[model samples]
Target: MQDREGIGKIMTETGKIVTETGKILTKTCKIMTETGKIMSKTCNIMTETCKIVTETGKIVTETGKVMTKTCKALTEKCKIIKETGKKMTETCKIAKE
Candidate 1:
């Protein structure tokens, strides 16, 4: 009878260990799935950021070219205004004399 009781205790202990191990495995699988989802989201965000950066760079380059052209046009206009003002002063002086 004592031997049978010992055997039953051993079986009960082994069954508990198996149950705990199964629970641990289920938890580990859940964690792995969550980690995979997080990695996928991070990859998507990085891809979008890269596309935005490329578009912004292109816009900056275009704006620089436009500013350069605008500056050159303004400089030419200033030169024309100075020449016209000088001619107007000369004409007024001749008329007063």
Candidate 2:
């Protein structure tokens, strides 16, 4: 009779362990589902960030083009001023002679 009781107690303990393991597995599945959702959101955010970077690059390129045009205009003005100075010096030399 004592042996039978011992066997029954062991079976009960094994059943309890199985039930606890099932609960743990269910919790793990829920955690995995939540992780998948978070990953999806992260991908969306990354895509938006890439688009912003592309737009900023376009703006920078346009600004560079405008600056180049302005620089060319200034260079042309400098050349004209230099030529006028040379002509004035020639006129002064002639007047002194």
The candidate scoring highest on lDDT is 1
lDDT of 2 by residue, 1-97 (tens): 9999999999999999999999999999999999999999999999999999999999999999999999999999999999999999999999999
Regions of candidate 2 where Cα sits further than 4 Å from its true position: 1-12
CA RMSD of all predictions: 2.8, 2.6
In candidate 1, clashing pairs total: 0
Model 1: lDDT of residue 73: 100
- Model 1 over residues 1-97: C-alpha lDDT tens digits? 9999999999999999999999999999999999999999999999999999999999999999999999999999999999999999999999999
How high is the lDDT of residue 64 in model 1?
A: 100
lDDT of 1: 1.00
**How accurate locally is residue 51 in candidate 1, as Cα lDDT from 0 to 100?**
100
Off by over 4 Å in 1: 1-15
Q: Kindly report which residue pairs in candidate 2 clash with one another.
A: none
| Candidate 2 positional error at 46, Å | 2.0
- Any residue pairs clashing in model 1, and if so which? none
